[model samples]
Target: MNTQALGVEYYLAGMRAALDDLPPNEVAEIMEDVEAHVAELSTELGENETLEQRLGSPEQYAQELRQAAGYPPRTERLPVTTKKQLVTRPRVAAWGLAIATAVTLLAGTAVLRQSAILLLPAVLLVLSLALVHDRGPAQQEIMDLPETRKIQQWLTPEEGTPGERALTYLKSLQPAWWLARAGLLGLGAVLLASRDILGFLFIAGIAVLSVFAGPRAKVDRRWLWFSLPASALAIGLLFQVIDVTANNLAYSSSRQVYQPPAMQSYENIYAYDENGKLLTNVLLYDQDGNPINAPRQYYGCNGDDPQPMIPANRYPRPKIDYENGSCYTVAPSVVAPSSTESAPPSSSGSAPSNSVAPTSVSPSK
Candidate 1:
């Protein structure tokens, strides 16, 4: 019990320490004794005076009780530091704490933007801290310091701290910050080869923007202008890469002869269906022993052009019919020739009425 200074805080602290070991019954007895003392004092003062005034002061009363109990006076004990004092904030301290807490909350929210689970505690903590820090110190002694000559200035009609002003400034830039974040995400997806790296960059961008939403961060970067558009452009270029790779693979597999391709005409063109794109020009070949030419594409065939041309380019002589109705190409086997030898003499027989196979040749008698 080192109560070097006797103050209100020390007086209560001493009592609390004594009560820690004392039973509930003992505490009740102490209370009753104090009440009895006050009552007696009240009676002596002739009911006109309050019991409080007759008792001198609460501290003095407690001191006398200590003497009567064979305990040292509360003033002779050391000061008892409390959790209350530790947590309590001075005016300036409160403002600084508020700014730091606000910044922390914003930073946390930004970091956890993708995860709702993480953002809640950070937000709750910020609000709680702000509520507490916004209040001035519990006790203030007024002095005639020139308001204008004060070391610090506030940004409002009412009074505030530089941190509050900073917070307000930060709040104003949130929209831009968010835009930048989305832009940076795109940029990262472009620049980062690994998926994990890209994901981290995306989260970082979100955090940066989220912090900007609070009243604590400063933003004055020039290169910030290109962040979003450049990211989008990069993403678009990736689409092109996918497209080229897909086309290359498609071309390699196009050699399968079993699956027929979309119909084409004289000048080569790609064909399409209602649903989507189709494989085109699978049986590529040309007449007169030449490489196939690009064929024209048509979705529908007119009455004059009923049967669409399917090139049967397997045989020799490479005959390709351009007739309107004949869906024609050369057969796969032998080639026909322009020149022919003379036919040998033959005997003719009359056709039978019901004989399915009646054609016969006999030597003339």
Candidate 2:
């Protein structure tokens, strides 16, 4: 960890411990200001003056914070909550968490292609359990405050609730919470090294803003202004990449007609089948003056070694010859002004020795 990161972690831990009796919302707010203050101080302090040298011990700094925030000194007794916190908060938090967990798990597994969504609920569950055991503010005036009553209630153990048993389990595993958070940071760092560092940093920043901004507290509009649009843009880019990749795969799978290079005037075309019976419907002008019927692709040949010949361009037109003797001559009158005429056949289905089919017309036609 960087010195700055370590200092922030230690200072925040002490602050949380010091403000244990306060409402979670208040603690969150105070910590936000503390973080901002520590960040500011870090920029100004000399190398000789560490955070401890400047701010003293975390417990002492926390006491100063409580006094500044108009709170009494820490006491051995448990904290108290208002009627609103007691009645409405727990149920609302429980339902909120339940719904959030279900949606996160489903969306992460189904849409985002990330399994890390499962870790989210586990972390939330740990925090929820820890909240159950922590004491709330005991001051009646503080509890009665309108602002405090309006905020969401923190989770705590209640009669007939599973949190009662869970609290003990959570308390036994407080050290694990630290480990989990550290692991999260380590994972984020690894992802930065191996994956998208900008994305990781952006997400980490958004998460920090969301936590410290508090549901009802006013911190900075800038964090909101930046995070929301940036997140939307990131999602948009992800969709675009997915769409482009799909298109590339679809295009790759579909057959492509080979286009010979423009630099080469003559293109060699060949076809072969191991069974040697590749038949194809061919459009040819018959011996009469009439054109053949509409020539869709058809199986026309039936034998092996259908030797192909291409007439050289020395002739007035290009033509093709099939040694199999399937192609027959078209009368000179029947051949279109544009169509190349096939050479006349001789005795026993053989083409005239001197008559040659032009090369270009056969495959193209």
Candidate 3:
């Protein structure tokens, strides 16, 4: 139940019970006073008995009146739509400037400050933008017009209005407004139930405002119930920043791409293979053979295959034939020793021979 109806119930029931303790005459006076006030409201609201029947019990009716007589402010308890539009110009400017500033700060420092602790600014900005109110006319401007007067008159029909019946329809909607608000609160609760702690806190705060804001506003219009869902929007936007940031952090830290040794070979590949062609390319994959699509370094493989080193070391190194001191690429007629010294010539006047297992060789480029 909305605070309006709920409060109304307690008011009337309490008043009624309290009256029971008074002298019979005083009890009669209380009933008469209540009846008089209701009659007054009925007259103002287009006195239609049918519309009044839609309003719940007498206790509920009396409670609504009691609330309008200056109940506690219900900032934390208004329905979503009935929420006061705190989004005014300076506040809007303030929020806009604040957002722009934050974007700049985050962009500049996100790289320099890796601490997830930047959440402090994010949360502070949210609360500041929400709670600040240094803008707008000090109070909402009440409209002044002949039509407004007409509307009020029609709503609160005089003892003699020609369309009492039409006004009655408007009057009948009052109770429905309360029920609609209650439904809104129910729906909000259903949604909040599935959310996290922050979400629940946001929803519950606004829902409480929903139940009481309308009554506190002393709104005479019956359609105010339509504005309640806006509370959910406000609360959702308020909490989404935190939720989104956390989600992004989780995503960024997972893993890097896969580069392979074959890719590394792409960089320093400089040799001819047995086929007399350059072996500039090599393919690498996991046991599953699914290609790893990253730079070779990413896979911790810079083309450092043991097979390639074996060929480069054992084979004669390329040398520039020193004819006229001109450089020419050719296999060395003699192999150089690793210690930068010439190896002793073989007795048969040929390069030393070796017995090794056969292996596949691709030409270098």
lDDT of 2: 0.44
Question: Each model's C-alpha lDDT?
Answer: 0.38, 0.44, 0.39
* Candidate 1 deviant stretches above 4 angstroms: 1-55, 65-97, 113-302, 311-365
lDDT of 1 by residue, 226-309 (tens): 222223323443454455569888877885645665443223222333333233344545566665543232222234442334
Model 2, 253: alpha-carbon shift in Å?
8.8
Best by TM-score: 2
Q: In candidate 2, what are the lDDT values of residues 1-365, reduced to their tens digit?
A: 23444475567666667776776657756766776788898788886666777887778899988898799788643434432255444443344344445544343222223424434544554454343322222222233344444542433556557876787677677445434433443333344444555545544553344334332122332232222322232343345446657989877766355544344222221112343322223233458845433211112334432333222211111122333544433211111122123232222222212333343223323
TM-score of 2: 0.29
List the lowest-lDDT window of 10 residues for candidate 1: 136-145
**lDDT tens readout by residue for model 3, 303-364:** 33322222332223333222332333344343222332323333222221221111111212
- In terms of lDDT, model 1 sits at 0.38
CA lDDT for candidate 3: 0.39
